[model samples]
Target: MGKVTAGLTMSLDGFIAGPNDGPDHPLGEGGMRLFDWYTSGDTDYVVPSGGMTFKISSRAAEMLQEVFSSIGAIVTGRRTFDITNGWGGTHPIGEHVPIFVVTHSVPEGWDYEGTPFTFVTDGVESAVEQARAAAGDKNVAVSAASVIQQCLRAGLLDEVHVDLVPVLLGDGVRMFDHLGREHIELERTRIIEDPDVTHLTFRVVR
Candidate 1:
């Protein structure tokens, strides 16, 4: 069994993506500023999927490496899957890790040989379950605001990691919206500070 975690870079005002986000504007207007920390340092870190690389601080690079290495599978929303164009057939985490997309219906031409994607139309719960099963001892990463919200509401998430950027986006897609009125207590577990971003981790208090 493995813990279900949700992680993403977010603005100080609690936005994950700026307003008017779409395929053409994946991160929304001016949202690219949120990722400035990725290339603001000297240490070179390559994505396991071999899709990209980043120059970050030694501490940030080491933390990212540890986190990336622990991920065995991913569960994300269809909107995110489409936003990144399915990460060009292979997720940035790695090709070996399976990705379960929570969607109402499978997209046409999405199925192909040696694909790492699996469409789950039933619900987020089913998708998370499948991801956990596939992950074995490793962690199941939940991505996208909608999917993470669903997991949080359903009590399926064990941890929340946020790369807190400095700037504040006045209007945009929020990461912690629609969670109902229930108070979800979180135990702060760790904080890794960098000049451009602050990595915060919390354990969901069940």
Candidate 2:
């Protein structure tokens, strides 16, 4: 059996990105404050939901290794993929992992280490179905704010690992925005109090 999940860093003030966001300001003004947790070195591939920073500690690393061990494919929102690939320039995802992108329209050329990119616009379910098929005997990783929120709303996410950094953006983007007035249960929690940042992991139980 396979499962889907999402993990993101957030602030005490509940902001994933700073204000003044746009295509030009991907992270938005002072948005980098949410990324302090990504200093985890070149090892961990930090995926920020709503652009919050969460440090990767030894415990978090071990947990991530455990969870990501069987990963065979990945899915992300268009904006997230664009920003990440644009930053990577050449190699992205650190490996030749199959990726499914959610977008209304396909771009001219989207390449990351020559890996194939598939665009999905039908819905989150359709995207996950394709990703799971491509994933084969491995776990499919969901790595975008909008995608995760959709999955969570659609009751698709199974587990999530997140690291919480110490910073307050005051405003910007948020990962759990569309969750609406529904109450989401907090299944599990792991707190990492490193000097650099405070990391936390949550396993959401639907």
Candidate 3:
């Protein structure tokens, strides 16, 4: 069995993305600042998917390597899928790692052959189930704000990892919103400090 986890780079103000996020403005206005840490160092780290490379601190590179290697599959929202244009047919984590997109309907002209994406119109739970089945012993990473919120509300997530950036976006897409009025307890598991960002991990106290 694999643990279900949600990870994202968020601002100090608890925003995962700046306001008005869309295809044209993927990270929202000034949201790209959230990822400045990716290039704020001297160490070169190539992504597992071979899609891109990042210049980050040695510690950040180590953390990224550990995290990326542990993920076997991903479950994300349709909005995210569309924003990245399906990661140009191959996700950043690599084609070997399957991607389950929670969408209302399959997009037009999306060929299934040789593609790692799976459009799950049924719902987030079904998507998570399918992703877990594909992931096997590795972890299933749940991305996107809405999808993560759904998983948290449904009690499907086991852990949450946030790369806290030093910024305050006055208005943006909040990561911890719409999770209902109920308090969800979390046990802090790990914290890695860096000049660019702080990596925080917590186990969902179910």
Candidate 4:
């Protein structure tokens, strides 16, 4: 079995999408700022490794790639999958890792860029089961809206890598929209600041 993780770039105000998110503007106005950490390749966001070039060139991307490399499967909500556009519809996983998208309506066999997309709606847990089974010994990563929340609620999230941007969005699609009354402890926090953004990692303690 592999660890399940929820990783996302968030704003200081605890938002992932800006206030005006929609079909016309999925990211919303000022939304892109939440991920400035990646665009600038700020060293502050880069984790200390053997000091490889890929680590410094694109820390977020490199981190994501490393994370994905260990992934045997992925689960994401419909809306979250849509955010990636039709690109994911045809090729859900960029690295050929299997992806199971939890959605209400399943198309008559969805295929993306030679990659097969399996849509499930039995429930979040069901999706997780299928993903984990398919993943076997590899990690199963869950991304997108409600899905991450559901996992967190189920006490399924083992760890998370957070790249905190240095901005505040007064209103937007927040990351923890429904954390409820439970409080989680932070195991660690690291800062990496560049001209574009600041990276912060917080390990979760249940």
Candidate 5:
């Protein structure tokens, strides 16, 4: 089975998103700034106006690329799927990277024109199992903060990588809030420092 891993860029204050995150503001107000490290690279993404490109530092881009290459499938939340407009019908992760969305109810005609999403309503464990099966030997990556927390609490996640951006969002959705009393063991596996952000990886000690 493929390893279940998750990664995200977060502010020092621990928010993965800023306030008022919605369809109009996907990452929330100024939340897009958190991903400056990745977008700084000449990475192309779909925007409302059309395709846009941004450049990040070469070293930061290279490190981000390494993480992107290992993901075979992605698991995210319904809110995330909605906020991104299903990644504008072309997932930011990749066109071929299948997404398994955990939701309470699968929407009618859930599949988009070019992008099809697998909606798992059973629970996070079912979503992870299906994502793992779809991923084959590569890693199944959890992208949304809520889903990442679910994986952590369920003890299904194998690794976590965070690009710790040097900023603070005083209010917003926190990444590690209200996780209950369960303790998850972690071992630092890698660290890469850059002027914009620091990339850190930790193995989930089993």
Candidate 6:
């Protein structure tokens, strides 16, 4: 079985997204600052923000590549999937990697020709099971915080990775909200520090 993992780039204040998140503003207001490191050289936002165009450290680059390479399938919430518009109606990750979306309602005339997308309305657990099967020996990663929280609360997540950015959003969609009263123990697995962001990985101790 494939291990279940989740990753999110969050602010120091613990928000995964900023206020007024919408279709036009996917990351939310000022949320793009959290991903500045990953998109340093891109011409789109770099020039306007006046952020320095610096190369990501070798270690960070290697770690990111490894994370992507290890994933065979992805599971994410309906909001996340819809916000990205199914990565513009085709799996942006790749044509081969399968994407399982957890949703209450399936979209009309859903179609992504080159890539495979499975809409699992049953629940997070069902979506995870299908993703794990699709992943085989690789990891099944969830990108959305709601899905991650669901997996964590249900004791289905194996690992949680966070790219901790230095900025604080003050108020927005928090990553660790509404987890109920259950206490989930985590063991530190890995940590890679960079000037812009720190990569932290923790194993959910069951």
The most accurate candidate by lDDT is 1
Candidate that scores best on TM-score: 1
Output the TM-score of candidate 1: 0.98
Clashing pairs in 1: none
Q: Candidate 3 residues 84-158, lDDT tens each? A: 899888888998999999999999867778888889999999999999999999999999899999999999999
Locate the minimum summed-lDDT window of 10 residues in model 4.
46-55
lDDT of 2 at 169: 76
lDDT of 1 by residue, 1-206 (tens): 88899999999999999999888889999998998999999999999978899999999989999999999999999989999999889888988999999999999887898889999999999999999999999999998899999999999999999999999899999999999999999999999999889999999999
Itemize residue pairs with steric clashes in candidate 3: none
Whole-model lDDT, model 5: 0.82
Q: Which stretches in model 6 have alpha-carbon errors above 4 Å? A: 41-55
Candidate rank order under TM-score: 1, 3, 6, 5, 4, 2
**Model 3 / residue 20 / CA error / Å:** 1.4
Question: Please, what are the lDDT tens digits per residue for candidate 4 over residues 1-206?
Answer: 88787777778788878877766667678787775444444344322222222323355555556775687888888876676564434442454566778888875545545654678879788888988898899888787657888878887777766667768888888888787897766676555555555556566687
lDDT of each: 0.94, 0.69, 0.93, 0.68, 0.82, 0.83
Q: How close is candidate 5 to the true structure, as a TM-score?
A: 0.89
Off by over 4 Å in 5: 39-54, 112-114
Q: In candidate 3, what residue range of length 10 has the lowest lDDT sum? A: 108-117
Q: Return the TM-score for each candidate structure.
A: 0.98, 0.79, 0.97, 0.79, 0.89, 0.90
Tens digit of lDDT per residue, candidate 2, span 117-188?
788889889999999998887777888778888988888877765556567777777767888888878666
Please identify which of the two predictions, 1 or 3, would achieve the higher lDDT against the true structure: 1
Candidate 3: segments with Cα more than 4 A from true spot: none
Q: On residues 1-206, what C-alpha lDDT tens digit does candidate 6 reach at each position?
A: 77899999999889999988878878898877887877653223222113323357777767766887789899998888877777765554566788899999888756646547888999999999999999999999999999999998899999999999999888778999889987899999999988778899999999
| Residue 68 lDDT (model 5) | 68
Better of 3 and 5 by TM-score: 3
State residue 197's C-alpha deviation in candidate 1, in Å: 0.6
